[model samples]
Target: MKSLFSVSVLIPVLSISMIFNSWAQNPDFPWPEGKRMALSLSFDDARASNPDPGAALLDEYGVKATFYVVPSGMESDIAAWKEVVASGHEIGNHSLYHPCSGNFVWSRNKALEDYTLERMRSELSAANEEVERLLGVRPEVFAYPCGLTYVGKGERTQSYVPLIAEMFLSGRGWKDEAPVDPYYADMAQLTGMEMDNKSFEEILPLIEAAAENRQWLVLAGHETRTEGNQTTYLSMLRKLAAYANDPANGIWIAPVGEVAKYVKEKRAEMEGNLNIPGISRPAEGETIYLTAEKGKGIGPDIKYMPEWNAFGWFTAEDRVEWDLDLPEKGKYEVWMEWSVSDEEAGKPFVLTSGEQTLEGIVKPSGSWETFQKTKIGELALEEDFNRIIVASGEDFDEGALMDLKALTLVPVGK
Candidate 1:
């Protein structure tokens, strides 16, 4: 299985350590390894239709999937759940109660006090307890209940994921598109790309595309058999089975948890080093930090500040920029690290530029917020300069201010 992934790791090696331990984007992330492989299907909500009679379908066909389960809803089907585990499907925590609201709510004391984390862990633990009790195995993968996109925004309600659980499982269902950021252990977390009743015709094309691109795809579902016929899903499974089983196609099927495990293994091999020349040269044991300030609200934590953009509205007083430069023209992956606790009490910073942007929230806790890193984007270098500039995307009140830390640039060794 490790052999199939080598195609993805093609960047410069020895230089990785320098990238990881820097203040800019760690160029060492998304360690290039093995051929481009796409993760197969995944289902959310622990639907009743899972572990279909076609339990062996994915593995027999060489495909893998992650099943985000809400134990409260599927507690009665222990046998079916066991079969799913026995057959090699990955089970992930989707929150104990699947609270539709309060998805982004978090607290500094989550692991120690919040019910969300405690209940989530308990629910997942209990589910794992049940699985181990029945199937003799414990589950690890975890998916956000509502694809909650947290970027250091809002009050203490925002749940902060402790580092202790970082390696628990691959992160899943973060969004509905291909993930480009490697800041996360498993950034490929996607949504609704498959289900029991969806047509083979509808699902096959996406699978084919992901395989061709060596990308990961996630399919989400709710109450699959709880409401519809199983034939379409069965047929879709059969088709997927064929695609996964065909080694010539280069598709590796595993549960989301399994995929996360694989990523952890591979990343461990590279050991958190990014290898881009010139822009960022992170040495081993170094770290990068990025900050986001306030502006017009884009989502929750993200703001639409024009001061950072070259085109946005801002004068000298409303502007902030970075000091960095690219070496050559080619593909590049960029990441920015951010800490919410660093902002002034009750103050959140809005960071942005023509292409780079982020927002960080400062809490009243006074404790420095932990680091949350994010990949900015992959750029096609067209020129070179002494120092690249990163500024605020928009203007803010004169009283408002944005801070600076580090800017990293990586030349994608494409």
Candidate 2:
């Protein structure tokens, strides 16, 4: 019998009404509706000894993946790292050090914060620069050292939101929690996995389940190879590759970066669904006209919070409006562009319609920056009203030159 997976319960939590039909799969918009899954084989805190076999398996099967390279762990295996990059696998910065940064205890540790912002800049930048120097490209993916999101045991409130919005396509933290809406956490800063003592049988089911759910299953591990003994790690890798390469089994193996890109793209597409019902955005290259007041303001009934950071650590206003039109109901996403006379960094702008909200925070590269998009969650629309509002959150002053460059209402499953 085929392996069983439980997705019904998770589906209600996910509420992905726009992206796929109940039976559709693979969310590349134009791609045919079929079950599409993505699997990422990520090696955490690089282990030199574990190189040959794992890379070989991926290479042999024509599969690509992401490897998280820590400064300490990669030095001894520079050649292998280069080879992996050359072989089409992506190399991502895994932090200079791999401390358990996720825990409240460690976030408060004096030694951790002792590395000031400048030091962090150098540390993370150095890793990217070095990887580029050797691999001919700077990596855009960053995973937290031990997956720390808060400082000294207190959450940053809306802090992580802006940080991820501005930079990095995606990131990984060390947590085994069940999936939540990527919007709540930075879609780029997602959860990852570490191989514990679970056997292949127990582990395989979980991997298969995640694949079935279309969740990006990130496998993190250390010491894939020892001086002489390489048993469990090798076995696990072989199993993963076998499952990944088998499309008949519904597993779509992709590089970690690619998976992130797909998820982000899907999120944006879903956002468009939230903007308007039965009106879908044309494929890229097709132009659409948007009103100055396409996305306006929030409704009085909903609670709204400030979306912090948005630009650099402190650039421009990164404001957002949530729960804007809960009752008007319809699927929609936000697509807009803006230019300011006085360039500012780190400002947040967003639009919320139905159950979804879209955000953008960055300095405009030009008078017109086109095609920037963000995803909104699942939504249901009611009759009678059709307009949605976009604005900064409850806090922060409004922005100048904000334009709804192009907006469209997309119908799902049409």
Candidate number achieving the greatest lDDT relative to the actual structure: 2
**Clash count, one per candidate:** 74, 39
Once fitted onto the true fold, the runs of candidate 2 whose alpha carbons sit more than 4 angstroms away are: 1-33, 99-110, 151-161, 179-185, 226-232, 274-414
Give the Cα lDDT of each candidate: 0.46, 0.50
Q: What is the C-alpha local distance difference test score of candidate 2?
A: 0.50
lDDT (Cα, tens digit) per residue for candidate 2, span 39-64 = 66676666664457767666888978
Work out the TM-score per prediction.
Answer: 0.50, 0.54
